[model samples]
Target: MLDHLITHDDNLRMVPTDRNELAAAVGHLQEELRALPEGSDTARARVLTRWIGIAQLCLGHHDEARTSLRQSLELAVTIGNSRAVVATGLNLGDAHRYAGDVRGADALYRSALITARYHHPELMDFALQHTGKHLMECGDPAGARAHLQEALRLRIAKGDAELVKSTQAALERVELLISQADASATGHAVPGQWSRQWTAWLQSRITTRTPSRWAQDFPTVRYAVAGLTAHQRVHPCHLRDQSFPSALLTAMAEEAEKAVAADGYLHNGKWNAATLDAVSLFVGQVDLADVVSRSSGLAVEPPHTAVYIAYEEGQRLDFHLDEFGFGEANLILCLKHERPAELPRASTTVFLTADSYLECDLAAGDCIVFDGALTPHGRTPLSAGESVTLVCFGFRAREQDSRTVTHLPPVPSGRAALGRPESAPAPRCATLCGHAGN
Candidate 1:
């Protein structure tokens, strides 16, 4: 019933009703118990162990609590203390009940009941009440009723109005269920016994034609689509927090560094450099492409691919998209520059005509993609320094019409095409049809 404030900030609070939260609380309390000095005080240990056992029971961590409380109970017995032993036994029984071990709970309750009779009558009453609950679970309602009724009488005699009221509510529900079951066993008919009458009555509640809004309001479920749409355009500047595998960037950088040093100069369009070789790992992580595609809404097209490599300072791209005709998305992966570069401030700028231009100054693993249709986009001139490299993948539909030309030539007959009039373009129809007049 206790609501704990999990955080020290005074605002973060949680209830123990949630299973995960209760389990976490048990873990926290265990840590606190472990911090206590060994043998500091047996009474204090007993108190902490009791609460810990209860927390574990609520969390459904029964075996863990049983182990903890059994040890504490053994210590209490060695000290000739009945109070702690009796309390721990009652808690152990509770844990057994929660784990659906009715017989084990009954044995523990019986032991606690004997100790409670001599040491504390209140605890004896508690044990009896729980024993009755176990009896009910074990399918002995008569025995359960006897124990529960006696427990209820004891509580009333002790003048505990709260316990009496609670016990009375339980007794009433048991009696009501028993009576209804007895009545149902006789030759009397229940409301739904007449099958034909019941079916007609239920059918009257239904309708052949329901409201159309019901169909719209309750939509059918659909699986997740791992692609992007070009219709929902996104700016290239939005991918500031994209995370990439670290090993990938290191391998790519090492590859690129090896290439430039070996040849005295790096060549364009050839990924043979050490950097490009390391790009395969990034490409292997298909989920990253799905994330980018969804964010950018690039049309689901052929060649779902991505490339990433590290770019040291002084590297530059002249401006080009992949060989794929339609440029859907370009992702740039960048790493932070440790120091400034030698040639002009190292920033990649895409020149989209004179009026509209875009510049990207990226940190490590940052990615962005844009539709090539929106003014030509490219990076700025690179200087000699640490800059980020990106593997850009362009996607297109799996299948596309091979015809490159948009316009069609005049037909030889000039007759109406199949399913189209002669006035319409030949491309609109698959083929032409001959008419006698032609």
Candidate 2:
């Protein structure tokens, strides 16, 4: 009976469209489990329960799926089936996540990641990807970037081009959010100009001392320090000299054009006017981690890269702060800027204070490095017949703690972790950008 049930369930999974067949298969599995004595066929019962949960999830019955998965997990634990435990945990997490229980979903995913790290290294990618995706939807781009970057590294190491492409796309979405957040904080209004004497005075004060020392020297300005610890502090922002080689810039620009043609432009809404993915190859080829480390005075890792394209008629980026994780430091390389000869040149501006802003009209191949997470910056909107393409690479400080780090307390027993099933209607299926709970 167990063998027949397993075979039938497998068939149903392969051809999931037939609701009647799926219902019949689930019924048979439930009947078989019921006929067996308690604990008599634990392993078989676990398989049946897990398959039933999967079937329930596929049919959009998330509550039933949760119940079945909880039972399946309990059985797996009882049998010491490590592989089954990991698999069931991931599925259960997805069900919870898609059902609008972000905290609950994260709890499950963290557990799965811990389990996989110890017992099933092969499942690490899946655990990370799902967890990252969940974090991204929850408005934690930094956390999402950390996991997604790690996942991308693993995929690239394994030479899986398809997975690499998908992971890269996910990272791009996170970057767009970070840019938008920074724009919102800075505001779109044109800032007033500062006198040259004022600019020189501020530069002299900061250039001669470390950020921590500067804070101490100017105690009154310390209140504006944003959020930097003395021990691992660096300047809030700085520009690097000739960061990108001319040839590399040209290659990156070509790559961006190709990607835009293949993937089409992504409308990011109030964040980026448009974006292109999988254009980070050149960035990865360079020793960006080292550059960021030296420039920011913090141990940093290689960047997660993307190409941002702004159109003449597109919306301008608003002033906002970057989230902590991937936004610790960012390197933006201007690739191509084509504008009408009659219009004034456009520039990227960083707001230093209410009375002053730093604007740079970067030529092709020029790059700027800044503490994106702590500073507010945005670009002036392009004029008619103007378009600009930029290669953006974001690096995280190695010593900086990730904001998503959570202490997972021990979960109580089966179904209790999810609380009693709610009377509320099941959530709609998860969408790409919205809440994962479907």
Top candidate (TM-score): 2
Residue 83 displacement in candidate 1 (angstroms): 2.1
TM-score of 2: 0.46
lDDT of 1 by residue, 302-378 (tens): 33333333345554543332222233445555533444644445545342222122445555555555543222344
Question: What TM-score quantifies how close candidate 1 is to the native fold?
Answer: 0.37
Q: Per-residue CA lDDT of candidate 2, range 319-434, in tens?
A: 44444444566777677877678876453433332222445555576566666544445555555676777767677667646322222111112322332134523222111111
lDDT of model number 2: 0.58
Whole-model lDDT, model 1 = 0.49
